[model samples]
Target: MISGPASVRERRLWMRTIAIVNQKGGCGKTTTAINLSAFLASETRRVLLIDMDPQGHATLGLLRDPSQLEKTVYEVLTHEQGVTALAEIIVRVRENLDLAPADVLLSALPEKLRETPGKENKLSEVLEEIRKDYDYVIVDCPPSVGLLTFNALKACTEAIIPVEPSFFSLQGIARQMETLDLLATTAGHNIKARALITLYTGRSDFAKAVAEEIRKHLGDRSFNTVIRFSLKLPEAVGHGLPIAEFSPRSSGCADYRALAREVLADEPPKFAPSRVEEDPEEAIAPAPAAALEQAESPLEPRMQVSPPIPVIGEGLFTVETPRAREEANSLPPAAVLEQAESFLESRMPAAPPMPINGEGLFTSEAPGAREETIPPALAAVFEQAESPLERRIQASPPMPVNGGVRFTIEAPGARSVQLAADFNDWVADEMQSRDGIWTKVVPLPPGRYHYRYVVDGGWQTDPLNVHLEPTPWGGYNSVFVLEGNNGNKVH
Candidate 1:
C-alpha cells in the first residue's frame, strides 16, 4: 500500500502532537494536517500524520486509497494490537512523512470504544508508545465534539483550529474553547491552541474585518500566517498530492510552508510527555488554573458591523495576495517546473491545442534562459491542456438554478446519479438523469452547503460551482450559498 524507502530509521526526538480540529465542517482541518505535515517533513523532520477522522480524508489526500488498504486506524483502535505493534498500518507517503490511514469502517469506532474502559485515553495510550519515533504527530480530527475528538485532544499537546473568514466560523470559537476547557478539566490535558485563518480571501473589507476581529479575540493564539483562498489548493487535493508536489509555484504551497516555519519557530520542549497510566475507576484530575480563567471569561464583543461576504468569488481566478507575490520569487524555480513538465508529458495524451498565456508562467528566468532551459513546446504543455475535471469549478458562477438548489454535471453514460453533501452526512442520494446530463434539486436552507455528485459509481464535483473546498477523500466539493430572507444577514 505504501511506496517509499524501506522503514525510516527510528530516532530519539521530542515529539509535538498537534490536533488540527474544528467543530465546523469545510474549515480546512484535513487540508492543514496533510500539507503542514508535508512541509514539516520537507524540512527533514520525521512526521506521522494520524488520520483520526473517520472520513479518512487525510489518508486519501496523501495518495493512499482507503478502499484498497487492508489495515487502517480502525483496526488499530479496535483491536488489542496498539499503534506500537501495528507498524504495518503506518504507510510511508514520502521520505519523512508517514500516515496511519483510516477508512469508512472507522465510523463504527465510537460505538466499539464506548464499552471499552479508558475510551478517551485509548489514542493517547497507543500514541505514547509510538510518539518517540517521530518528531511530530499531526492528528486530523473529525468535525464534531465526541469521543474521537476527545481522544485526539487528549493525545495532543497543541491544537490548530482552522477558521474560515466568515461570521459563523467566527462565532463558533467560543463553543470550541468551552469544549477544550471541559476536556482539560476531565481529561487533565493542557493543550496550546492557535487559531489559523484558512480559505481566507483578503480582498473584501468584510473578510478582512472578520479576520482581524478573530485575531483580536484570540490574541496570541491566532497564527500570523493566513492560508489565502486558492483554487490550486482544491486542485492539489484532487491530484492526490501535497500542494508542493502538485504545484510548487501555487500560493497554497507558499502559505502552508510559512505556517510550518511558524509552528517550528519555538523550540519543542526537551522533556518527553508525561505518560499517565489509565485507571478505569479513578476520578479525573482537577482543572488547571488557566483553564478556570478561560471558563470564566466571555468572548470579546465585536464593535463594527459585519458585512455580507459572498459565498463564492465573483470571478474564476483569485488575484495573488502580496505575500504570495513575495513568495513567488524564491519557489523551487527550474527543478520543480521541469519536473511538472516531464510529468505532464509522460502522463497525459495529446488533446486539442489550448494555448497557454506566456505571461502567466511563475518564474523570473531571463527570456534566453527560459527558451533554452525548458523546451517552449514542453512549457506550453504545462499551461495548456487543463482537463475538464481540473477546470470544472471555473466553468460558471454559483447561482441557484430553480426554486430549490439544483446541481448539474455532464456525463455521457451514467446509470444512476447521486449526491453526497453536508446536509446528508455525505451519503449518496440518487438523482434524475436524461441523455448525457444529470441533475439533482433539493430544498436547502439559507446557509452555505458543500456537495459533490456521484454519477453512476464515479464521483464528480460540480463543474459550474466556483466555491470549492478540499475533501478528505482527495477531491473538491462544490459549495453554494442561498441568501437568507434578510438579504445580507449573517448566519
Candidate 2:
C-alpha cells in the first residue's frame, strides 16, 4: 500500500485517469492497458489498473484469478443497496501497482443499472472518493460501446486508442475518434485522445506503409513509440508478470519503457467543466449597477517600462538603470549593498588598475583577473542576466571529471529524487541526498544528452541548469554535452 501524508497527497487536485477504449477487439487495447500501467508503476508512480471489461483479462494479465475474488468492480458498480467503496476491491499486484479485478458477473452491470439515475457516472463518483491516493488510474474498457464504456469515458480525462498496423484497425480508429468527440461534446468534458500503433512488424512493407499513413493522418496526435511485434510479450502475460520482470532486456520491455517516458514528459490533461442547464432569463440578465458603473469608467493607460541596458566595466561591474540608481540613492548610507560590495572586492583576485577616461569611461588596459566576483546580494538580481559570461557564471553548470559528470540539485523538502536521461534508457536511477542536496554521478563518453529530475514522483527540469529544449509533450528537457574532460550546458 502506498501511503503518504494527507498534506502531500493533496498537492495534486486529482490523479491522472486514462481510459483505454476501442470498440474493435484484438487491437491490443487490453495489452496496452496492462503493460502501460506496469511500466508506469516501475517508474515509481503509484498506479491502479481497473478491469472494466467483464472478461477480466487485465486481472489475469497480472496473474490474479478473478473468479476466486470475494469482491470485484462488479459489486462496486452494481450493488443494490449502495455502491461499494473502491478501496475494498483493490488488490496489491506488484510494488506500487494495484488491481481492481472483474469477472463474468460484471457483464450484467448494464442491465442492472439501466433504470438507475446517473448510471453513467457510477464509476466516476466512486473514483472521486480516492482520487488523491494514487498517481494514475488505468481503466480497461470492454470491446463494445455500452454502459461500461460510457462510465469509463465519463470518468477519464484522457483516452488512448491502441490500433494494430492494418487497414481494419485504421478504419476502426476513425469510428473510435468520432465516439470520443461525441462524448466530449455531450458530456461537456474535454478528453485528450491519442493514437498508438501496436503489434507492428517493422520488416513488413505493408506494416510500414500503414504506420506511415496513420502518422500522416494523426500528425502530432499519434505516439512516436511503436509497439513492435514481440513473442516474449504473450509469454510474460501468460506468466502473470510484466515484461520488465520476465524479460527486462526484451524489445517489448524497451518499447513500453519508452512509451512510459513519453507519457511522463507531458503534463496531465486538464478537466473541462460539465455542461450546466441555465434559464434563458438568467443567461441574458442586465448587469448590476456596480458592474455597469465600473465598466463605464475609462480604462487607465498602463505604463510600459523598458528592460535595463547593461554597461560592463573593466572589473566586470555593471551600471544600474536610472530607476535602480534612484532607488539605491534613497537607501540609508549604511545600507547592506555597500558592505556586500566591499566584502566581495576584498575576496576578489588581484587585478591591474585601469586608467579611466573622463567622458566615455574608456579603459586603458584589460583586467588581469579572468572571472568576475559577484556579491552575495547581487547574485539574485543577476539571475536573468543577458550576457553569456554572466549567465554561465550564474548557472554554475556541472563539470565532468575523469569521464564522469556529477549531477546535483537542491530540493530542500523533497522526499526523494532520481535522475532520468537518454543515456540510462530513461529509467530513473535513485539519487543520494545530503543536507537536502541530491547528487548522482554517471560515467559517459563524449556526447550530447537530455535529462530530467524526478522529484517525489513529479518530473522537473534541473533548476540550476539554464540550457533546455522544449519537448513535444509541452515540457522542457535539460540538455548537457560532455566534451573530453569538460561538460558544456547546451540548449
Candidate 3:
C-alpha cells in the first residue's frame, strides 16, 4: 500500500521540476505524468501538475470539475498575459497535491504562440516564475511534435518519455532525439538530457525483448526499475486519483513508487548554456561567451550591416557547430571532405579478393597477430522448461552441504525438467523437475556451486535472470544469474 503523505509545506524545500513528454500517443506519457506527480505528492513533496495538453486528460483525471478554471496555462502562455506567479492558479487536490488545469484554452494558445517573438521559450519563462514554489512541477505534454511540445521541452530541466514496447517505438526515438536536439540548440536554455522508457510488460516475452533493445540504445540513460503491466493502473486514473492513492495495494502502485524513487534518486540533468568552458580546452585559451552580436567596421565606407567575422573571435562570429562525429575545432564541410579521403581509407574494412592467376599469396610478418580474439561459442538448447525457469547447472560447496534448501521452476508447459549441480558430483543430482517445473531440495551450505538446468535432454538459461558474455562467433550471449556464492549471505 502507498504511504500517506506527511505534510506539503515540509517538502517544497527539495523541489525538482520534471516534464513527461512523448509524441507517440498511447505510450503512457500522460499516465506517467499523472501517476508520478501523484506518487511525489504522496511522499509529501509539493507537486504542481501542469496539464499542458489541450485534451486535458491529466486535468480531467485530477480535477472534480474541468471547466471551473478562469485562467489556465494556455492563458499564461498567450493572450498578452504574463505568467509571473504560477502558484496562484494551482488547484489544490490533496494536502500536498496541486494542479494547473488545461482544456480548450491550450488548443488556441499554439496558434497565438506562432505569431510571437521568442515563441519557443514562453512556457519555460512562465515555469521559471513558479519553479521554486514546489518540490516538483510535472508538465503533461500533448501527443504530438509541435510548438506545445517544444515549449514543454524548453520549460523543464529533464524529461521522461513513455514508450510502449512495439515495432514503432524504436523508430520514434530517432524523431524524439531530433526534436530534443532542435530544442537544445534553440528553445532549451537550461534544459538537460531527455529520456524515459515506459508501458513495459515484464510478464510478456515481447516486452522484455523490446526493453533489452531500448536498454542497449539508451545504455546508462535507462532506469533500472521497470514497470510491469497491471489492470489497476487505469482504474486509479478513472477515479480521478493517483495510482498510489487509488490502488495502493496494487502492483501498478508499487511499480510507480519504485519509478518515483528511481527518478528522485537520479542525478539532476544539466545542459550547456551557450557552450561553457570545458576542462582541457580552458587550459590553452578561455572561450568567450559570444551572444549573437555583430560589429560594424569603420575601415569600409560601403560597409554592409556588419563587417565579415572570422570563425572564432571576430566582428560577426558565425558560430560553426561541430558534427556529432567531429571532436576537433569547428570547420566547414569542405575541410571535413578534404580530410575525409584519408580518414575514409583508414576506416574502410579490407577484404581479400578471389585469385585469378592462382598466385595471390599475401604473406604477413606474424600469423599470431591475426588470430581470433573471441572465446568459444556455447549455444543454449531449450528443453520444455517452466514458465519462470530455474536451471541450476552447478553448485560448489567445498565444505559440507546441509541439503534442505529446495529450488523451484515455474514452467507450466514442461512436466519434467531436471536441475543438476556439481556439488552432488552429477551422481546424486538432488533437484528434479515436476509439473513443468524443476526443483532441487538440498542443503546448500557454505560454498559456491556452478549449476545449469537440463530440460527434456536440452540446455537453456533461466528466464528470470541473464548473464552477459561474449559468444564464440565474435558476438555476445545473454546469461542468467543466481546469487549465494563465495561465502555470501543467503537471501
State TM-scores per candidate: 0.62, 0.53, 0.51
TM-score of 1: 0.62
**Candidate order (TM-score):** 1, 2, 3
lDDT score of residue 141 within candidate 2: 95
- Residue-wise C-alpha lDDT for candidate 2, range 1-491, written one tens digit per residue: 11222233443465889999988766678778889999777656779999998777788788545556888898898764464799988999988899989876788998999899999999999998778788789999988899999999999999988887665678889988988888978988778889888766433345556777887789878876667555456556656878777655455665676677667656333322122222332121221233223322211211111221233554333444454545544666435343322222122111111101001111112334222333333343433443222222111234454458778777779999999999999899998887677878788876778899999999997754434566887777877665333342211
In angstroms, give how far residue 405 of model 1 lies from its true place.
9.9
Question: Could you give candidate 1's per-residue lDDT for residues 1-491 as a string of tens digits?
Answer: 11221233433446788999999876778889999999878766789999988777787788635577878888877773543444668889898899998876777888888788888887887787776688889999988889889989999999999987777787677778888998889767789999988866443446656777887788788887777665566556755789888766555665686677677665333322222122222211221233223322122221111111111142111233343334433445554344333322212111111101111111111222212122222233333334212322221223343456655665667788788888899899987766566666676667877788887688776653334566786767777655444222121
Give the Å shift of residue 302 in candidate 2.
Answer: 62
Superior by TM-score: candidate 2 or candidate 3: 2
Q: Order of all candidates by lDDT, from best down to worst? A: 2, 1, 3
User: Per-residue error at 482 for model 1, in Å?
Assistant: 5.2
RMSD of each: 15.0, 21.0, 25.0
For candidate 1, what is the lDDT? 0.63
Clash totals for all models, in order?
Answer: 1, 0, 27
